[model samples]
Target: MTSPAPRDRVDELTVGSGARLEELVDRESLGQLATSFADLSGVGIRVFDAEGKLLADAAQPVELISYLSTLKHSRSAIESTVSSVKNLDPGPEGQAGIDGVSGGRYRVVALEHDGRRVGRLVIGPYFPPSLRDIPSQLLELEPALDLDRARQLLTMAPRVTDDSMDRLARHARAALDVVMFSGLRALLTGSMHLAAVRESYRELQSKQDKLQVAYDRLKELDRLKSNFLATVSHELRTPLTSIIGYSEMLLEGIAGEITGEQREFVTTIREKGEQLLTLIKGLLDLSKLESGTMSLRKATMEVAPLVRDVAQTMAPHAKKKGISLQAEVEAGLPALWADAERLRQVLLNLVENAIKFTSAAGSVKISARLSSLSTGGSADEGGLVLLGAQRTAVELRVADTGIGIPESERQRVFDAFYQVDSSSTREQGGTGLGLSIVKRLVEGHDGTVHVEANEPQGTAFVVAIPLKRATLRP
Candidate 1:
């Protein structure tokens, strides 16, 4: 026999205490490869316990239950002979093959690695042991079955060389090592993936914190600027009052007679003082809007009457400048739900700016009609439908053939204290707060204000106010 001739030589592969022999199998790949090895062995190579309990078996057909049962009984004797070798350590204990009966008997090979008896393999179903000739048990199963024919079929198990069996056991051990290494690789991959995700989460959290901090700071600075303007404008009003009052008194010669030249200069002073007062008031109103302190007293009022009233109030100023001022309102317009005072202020401011900027003989027209809006907060221009009166809004546009605001300056003009032609002291002479105050007051009434170019001519200021304040509720 070309076998190892050393059934008991298994002292080298012991792992540790309390661990079972099956733990030595690499669980992930054990099922995959054991079947392949069984096919190559060419034997009924089955693993079983000392008492013949089946563990794993190859070369066994599923349909042959009766034959399998017969084999089970036959394999026990083989297992018994293999178990005898378990007592010896790491060297040849004994030979376990059956003596020639019908032909050659099966061998029960005790499997050992590193001096530990791990399991037993039945390389058999061949011939019976000569010691128990014919193994009387087989004949007893069915008297009619041929003993000799059965014996011939049973002995056809693989006849591996003894030396080759030892080599095969080493092959099985090497295959298990490869499977265990692959398992380690999978574990490493999973660990790396988990680490990457954790790192990404941490980086995102850091960036979010920075953005939140920046936003809060910007909000704080904006509020501070509003408060500053409110305080400064209030203080300025007290002094401006005396200047305008005394200048008027001087013009009228209240204390004594005055020369024509003196009267003319005093009148100019009084008028300029009043203009300063208007600018100061605009600043205060804008601050109120910015600080969210503006109060709205809403009423249901018709749009046509308001349009007529604003244009009439602004007519004299427009006429003096030789600018044609006109009022146009959609007849039978539905009433508006609005803060009457704030709405009036918005229209008046737009008209004043139109009349003030337009040159002689240019036209300034104030028009009102229903406008529909598709967006909330009135932030962007959108598809809008005017409903009963106007479901969406009333757009009051003051169009003028004036020096049009540059595209870059249009958005900036609505910013507090910002203007297109502003210097330390501007030549046009109105505090730059007019449009800013107008914008804030409009928004306070749940409306919006912006400027556009009067095509081919000058600028148009558009004020769109919602009939109902639905965006923010108390």
Candidate 2:
């Protein structure tokens, strides 16, 4: 009683036990198959999927149907008959037929694939061999019916025996079975490939989640280690300072006169105590830097004066090692916006390291020059350049003619507690925290520092600090 749903709406229904006809073969292929069969059998054909969705139709135009459509009553009868035939079930035998009022007939045959019915084929509007005349029901249905024209058009329709029509329908279904088999194989292969890819993605996502958890745990452990170092260093500094002070007092006779051997022992005690205090201070500074809690008292300061001051502070140590120490500052260089004290510490660390490694008569030079940073080139090769727009910066180089660092080990020197000469009998002595602290301090000021091989020998530590205060990071 109800009209069939629109083709797109019917197509949206999921295929159940049987696959949909449309999925097995494309409409173009189905239409071609139907057209070929209709041409060979001399009977018009229409195909519909299980859900009554028309897949394709190949119908030879009939003048009788066209003339009937022009008359209101006859047109209604024709439409009702067509709808009934479309909704017709062929039954378990998979064959059924409906006779039209005009003495024409339609044969409906089930389309089966893989032992299940997927759709139906309609072999329609063909005159049966037994039909002798147009029925009176058609002639009386419309008052405007042209009797002579209807009779002539009915004769023109294809005439075929019932057995021949049935054979054609079976043959058409057989041809479609081949197409459906190939299509089903392709569909299954594609589905399996998609399933495999989805499984691989799920596995990758699971591993990524586990890695993220492990990385977070490591970060938390590192933070706790920094906290522990800060607390322990603070507690150790108080007693170590007292030891150094007492040793100085005993050597100076302020704690009473002492023998030469006692003085010698006291001096060693004072020196070792001072070294230990320096190490503790380095640890405290490192902890603060790592936790991003170190505050900078930044002000506009000249680079030349800062360079000269750092060289002067380290000059006595360089002279003590019999190394030539010099400071070269370019005049009229632009001022830098940074914490003067932190910058001094950075320069002092570099210069002291240079002097410590240099042999007797080797030279250690600290120089400051106006340099510009651009988005290219390596800093260690010469003046430092970074990946950014051009900006003015002050470049400081602490170059020494000492035991040269190998190219492979140069970069690792800036890592915390990393030493190039790490052997127990190495001549130079350091806790290896100095360069690490220097790197962090320079970066806090939004500056860059790197080490490169010195010309012909030793190592050069280059520091480039931008002149702009706004560029400095907290």
Candidate 3:
């Protein structure tokens, strides 16, 4: 089989490297150079690469060669002399050669780039002013040749002195060197731009891969966390129930009458046990919710009664802190489609959080109102429900005048066990699952809950539960 053609090499050169002049210059550009040089010098010019490939030619005067070809001997002599001129080697940089033709001479110059010889530029076939008669080469080849016609043809060729042709050739070479330098610059600049783009893409791909790996690791860790919570919470609940039961029995004098101090200790044990049990239950609930196993029992319920009950239950705790707690339900508000017990748990958590975070003499208010929701507008738009809009839902807002939640921590506080103040010296205390459980329970009712800055000072937890009954299913 024939060997595959060698891949065409790219002409792009690194800085300071030598390049083939033909590779740097194209046919059109060579033609332009030849035309411009010929015009400036009034001498025929031809260009060729090191490989002897003819790149361009301009202004060749054929009068003398065409006239000599009419006779056999003269034609042979002319052909031989022309071949000799073309075969003349461009010897050195800045060096011009004078090759004698049948009636004139040719001037040849070497083209160099980056201090290395790359090609040849031939400018000539011009008669020197000293020529007074036809050359012997033509005369000896055809003794019968017409001297008159031969001399006239010789005169017809471009006439220039040797020194003038050398100066013109130098100018042409300098012009071409400038063009080559510019061409190389453009090529290198474009290559660098492409390289930059490729590097940027590679860096972006690397970052995306790293992000994917990190995300996968986080998912695995989350799964492990859920599994641990489920196992440990289940193990703790059984023992905690016994602790609470035994402590309650002792406080009730089931083990015989106890001293007042002993009763107080037993009561503390029961309360602590209950508190620990509540924490374990919250963990269990969170695990179930994360694992998509938590279930809710939905029912249509009055918003006012539930809001009032939660506020009342949390009132004494608020009072102990010297913080006021109150509830306000808008008149004629409709019932909500929700799980009543879960909804009450949600309100209790919110009210308790508000009281716990509030300073002494602060206030916590639980208010509910009919709110019509649209895609773009708020719920209180004259209670007008547009087509495809949701009917009025009950918005239960628990607002507090407390040492308010920082805007940054408001969203994160609802994540399981995430505390706004996690440092050991924090003034407030509790397992941080209250808001997390509240968020999960509210979402289970097809409701939305969010926190915003309460006017002037403090935070508000707004819960919007739809009035329409949901199709409850697992």
CA lDDT, every model vs. true structure: 0.64, 0.84, 0.79
Candidate 1: stretches off by over 4 Å:
1-201, 377-391, 423-427, 469-474
Better of 1 and 3 by TM-score: 3
What's the lDDT for candidate 3? 0.79
Tell me the tens digit of each residue's lDDT in model 1 across 161-214: 655655564565556446544554554354445556666887899998998899
Q: Mark the regions of model 2 whose C-alpha exceeds 4 Å error after superposition.
A: 1-19, 26-44, 57-61, 69-80, 92-95, 129-132, 136-145, 156-175, 178-182, 374-388, 469-474
Worst 10-residue lDDT window, candidate 2: 8-17
Of 1 and 2, the candidate ahead on TM-score is 2
Tens digit per residue, CA lDDT, model 2, 213-293: 999999999899999999999999999999998888888899788999999999999999999999999999999999999
Q: What TM value does model 2 have?
A: 0.83
Candidate 2 global CA lDDT score: 0.84
Per-prediction TM-score to the true structure, in the order listed: 0.62, 0.83, 0.66
Q: Write the per-residue lDDT of candidate 3 for residues 324-401, one digit (tens) a residue.
A: 888899997776767898899898889988998899998999999877444344444654434345546678999999
Arrange candidates by lDDT, highest first: which order?
Answer: 2, 3, 1
- What is the number of backbone collisions in each predicted candidate, taken in the order shown? 26, 0, 1
Clashes in model 3: which pairs? 372-379
